[model samples]
Target: MKSNILTIMKKELARFFGDKRLVLTTLVIPGLMIYLIYSLMGSGMMSAFAPSEDQIYNVLVTSPSEEFVAAADQLKLEITEADIGDIDSIKQKLRNGEIDLYVVFPEDFDQSIASIRVGEAPDEPLELEMYYSSTEVNSSAAADIVFSYLDGLEESLSNLFNINSGSAQYDVATDEDATGMLFSMLIPMLLIMFLFSGCMAVAPESIAGEKERGTIAALLVTPLKRGDLAIGKILALSIIALLSGASSFVGTLLSLPKLMGGDMVELAGIDAGVYGVTEYLTLLVVMLTTVLVIVAIISIISAYSNSVKEATTYITPLMIVVMLVGLTSMFGNGAPTNPVLYLIPIYNSVQCMNGVFSFSGSLINTVITSVANIAYTAILVVVLKKMFDSEKIMFSK
Candidate 1:
């Protein structure tokens, strides 16, 4: 029995080693995919959150303290004194991610601290208001640095001053902007992945499975034009994939708020209703064009393959590319402003979605992305049609 088992294992090893594609799919692709995924994610996260070494944080202070000025200099923070009348404008700058930190010190803060150090206890603790946007990375980092120094100072001075203490909200990010930022970062990547998965499910079966079963031969013999057949199949597959993706998209939107917050009270203002029909329509357009491009690409791969399993194996690399493209949504400070970047397939869809969800989507960019995707899909459709016409590819073993 042991000899027989060894003989069988040797036969299996011989078969496995003989099939280069099988070996590649089974071993090489998975390791490569994992490495690329992790590398892309690490790079993306670092680029998104990591501050530059030469970066000097811009800080706006209302009532400047001499000691705090010294501390700011040491911290590499550029301090600009502003009048109380400029608070609203300064906060607007923060919201726009222009400046990093806004520090509002109590009038005569030094005097107040000096009196406290002289054994004079005030009626109430002086509050230092630090206004920063949670959505802005620099603002958040600066807030941390400034707050740490103030925290140490407070401890030394016996809690003479409070930092952002009250029922008032100091983070100037509105509920809508906060919600948009979160959604834009996550939804684009997820949406593309879902669309790709949808295409993967049906494309292989429709083309490769039919070819494997010899049913596609019968269709080829029919009076239908190859271009028409290609168009029909692609359109049908795109619609089906869109439906599949839509289901996941809707479900994600519905459950996202709950995933974000634990309770209803915390999730009160975090509703998807912040997006109106225009935004939804914009998302729908992006998804529609994106689905067409995905379907066309998958169908071509499927046509080139002889079996469902082989088609799936062949498509794995493309799937990885799609995933990496989806990850571009997390790379920079919002979507890329370059109109030419919209000409690239898959990436354009992600950026368009990012813009719509983030409420900063340009109409020109959306138009460019849609047009480019449509053009790509058209070219892919032509290639697919040619593949359908080629007896060699369609009837491949």
Candidate 2:
């Protein structure tokens, strides 16, 4: 029994790996594509967030005091004085990307600070209106720089008035929370997509390709049981799919730092210590079950189709559904606490991943999802066996 399954698995593996073109297209190309795409995206994001040194930022200031003007000059900023009435025109220019930022100071802005220094309540609270167009990268960058300047000004004013607001408070987010926020949203969706792509690449070619070439008939005529054949085919295809998925997974991990603005540890605000062996093992379990389920589904679809082209066409809708299900990780707050939700195949894997990555995954839920996936794969294998037994389905024109 083991020998028959191994023979079938070996044949499938040989057929896939023996062909250099198939191996290249199926395995090598995906990782390269992901790395290239993600790196470019990360580079673009960094560029957008950073200000260009060569480009002079146009700043429009309304009712600026001498101190404010001195600060602007000290920063080597290109400042334009505009009256309150010109605010509408300046906004229009901002929308047109003609200017980077505008700052409006209330008349007697310095007088308010002076009043506070003398222990007198100002007639009105000090206010400043700053505007920038977010759609323009330069405008946004300029706005960030201006915000830093204003923060410094605020600190200086507070010190001058001897206003002690206790000790400084730092960011309240913990390392786990930061890491969880970064990985939970991205990793689950990426894993599902890679697994599905891997299965899609090989499953149809294994089953439908054989059927289309009439090779399945020869195999059926042999002493192998139809159930064994189905199991062997599913297992072989799962191995290949797992390899493909792993390739893409590695690519994603390697490129994620660049994707998240080039500093993974800094960006996640956590060290590798955050995810211990337990989390990795949980992730591995989720990935293994996910590949099995995906491969089984694709195998069943492939068996039903008369040709590889037809199989791919039939599987396209399933791919779409997988992608849609993967998106749940992005919008979802975290893994749902309800155990019943863990029974939903692809969605369950996604949630399990989210939970595991966030360090909040339920072991019971993970176990349920894994068991449910295996159960579903078993059902698919049985259906595939029936399809194999049906001469009409196997040899249909």
Candidate 3:
């Protein structure tokens, strides 16, 4: 039995390595994708830091206070006066890349404030609308700057009215540890995204490519059990997946310092010692889980695909979903709750990763979650072998 398995493993590895494209599939393509995603993200953040004059922010003022007018002028913005124009026009312009912002001042502007009696000069809050252009990298940031200035205007107008904005009703209760909230979101995302993307470069092509070349049928006759064949393929993919995870792990770590740009928050909770212990242990578990899930999914996807092209097309949506989940996690969103969460496959691994990063979650949760991921992997192996055993999959178009 051992020799049979070894023979299957050796043959699978030989097939993959025999292709000069293996290095590119297993590492190069994944590395490039990682670089592209991280580069775009890092550049976005860097743009926020670097001042540029070409950032010509357009503003539409429905009604502007003297001070609001002055603020726009000082910023050298092209301020256009429009009242009750089609909101659609503004949106259309935004879509066509015409304007960066829309600022509206209510008619009661000063009257509402004076009537409120506290910060009364005008009751109306100057509403600044920013429409972001998906194509423009800085459209969102430009909107942020516009809104920030408008918010300040609101505060300043109150001060000028001699109205105290402070309400004496105090709701203050301190003394809680909230340091770990970040881990609950960001770590899970990274774990999910890296694995999913890495799989894209290998899984579809590995199985479907062989089938396309009529190579799988030849291998099926080589005295290897269908189960071992499935495992051997999964094992090869797992090694490559582990490498991708490790590379991404190192890349993200290296980029954090740059991404944060000397921020204390980046410096505060993380270090080699901390990662080497808790984070590393958790990351390893997360990675193992990710590989299993990805391999299973890929095997299923590849089995149904008669060609690599069809497989890629079928799996692209899955890639997008994985990316969206990962992106959500990057913003600190995914977290684990019940034992059922641990049983939820890919999402559970991310939740555990987040818990590990925060250091507030229990070890029991981690262990249970890890076991669940491995359990999922085992089940997938059975399903994959069933595919291998089927004559329909072997010969079907």
Candidate 4:
């Protein structure tokens, strides 16, 4: 019995090691994929959070103090003296992301601090006002630096001065901008993954499963044009995938605020209702085109495969590519501007979605992406039609 068990174990081991593809997929590919993905994610997160070396934070100071200037210099802030009369214009710049920060100081700011440090307490703490747009990254970063320096200074001086003290909101960013920023970073990546999953679920079954069951051969013998058959399969698969993707998209959108934490949502005041019908309609167009592309690509791969399991195995690499492309939205400021980039299939969809969610996407780019995706799908359909007419592929044992 021991010798028989040993022989069985040897046979099993030999079979597992003999199939290079199985070994690669089950053992080698997973580790390599994890390493590559984590490396990319680490790099992406670093680039997203790390400030650039040459970044110059533009700041406007009113009634500037020597100590304040020194702090600004230390923080590498580029300061310009502004008049209180021009404060409204300066605020407009902050909201528009033209300037990083606007700091208002008391006329005798340094003198006030000196007097306060000598144990002279006033009826009210001296206040320093900082105005910035939270939606603008540079402005937010600048405000954080100033706040940190002031916090230390306040501690040393026994809280002699306070920063932006009160119920008054100093962040100049609009509610719409805040909503856009939150949605853009998360929605595009999620949308692509859902759409891809939808395609993966149906495409392999429709094409490769049919082939496995020998139904594809019978269907090929029918009077239906090969091109029509390909198009019909693609459209049917796309509709199914679209329904699946839309359901998930709606669920994700509805759940986002809750996912972001209820108290934080209430505090940040991010309203999902900020998006109008125009944005929704634009997103619908993007989703429809993206579904078509995903379905077409998957259908072709499924048709090329001889069985459902084989198709899924073949599609895994493409799934990884889709995930990598989806990650682009998390790293960039917005979509790429080049018209040519809108021609690449999966990438264009991700960028277009990114742009639309951010409210920074151009109409021309969206149009370009839609047209390019449709064109690619048509080409893929032609290729699929040719594959359908191939006897060697369809009738393969």
User: Any residue pairs clashing in model 1, and if so which?
Assistant: none
So what's the TM-score on candidate 2?
Answer: 0.84
Clashing residue pairs in candidate 2 are none
**Tens-digit lDDT string for candidate 2 (242-269):** 8888889888887777877656568558
RMSD of each: 15.6, 3.6, 8.3, 15.8
- Inter-residue clash pairs, candidate 4: none
Q: Taking the tens digit of each residue's C-alpha lDDT, what string does model 3 give over 40-94? A: 6776776765546567677777766565667775665778888868888787877
Candidate 3, residue 360: lDDT = 46
Q: Which candidate number would show the highest TM-score if scored against the true structure? A: 2
Model 3 local distance difference test score = 0.68
TM-score of each: 0.61, 0.84, 0.63, 0.62
> What's the true lDDT of residue 362 in model 4?
91
Runs of candidate 1 with Cα error greater than 4 angstroms are 1-159, 166-168, 264-269
The local distance difference test score of model 4 is: 0.80
lDDT of each: 0.80, 0.87, 0.68, 0.80
- Among all windows of 10 consecutive residues in model 1, the one with the lowest summed lDDT is 1-10
| lDDT score, candidate 3, position 111 | 53
Q: Pick the candidate with the highest lDDT.
A: 2
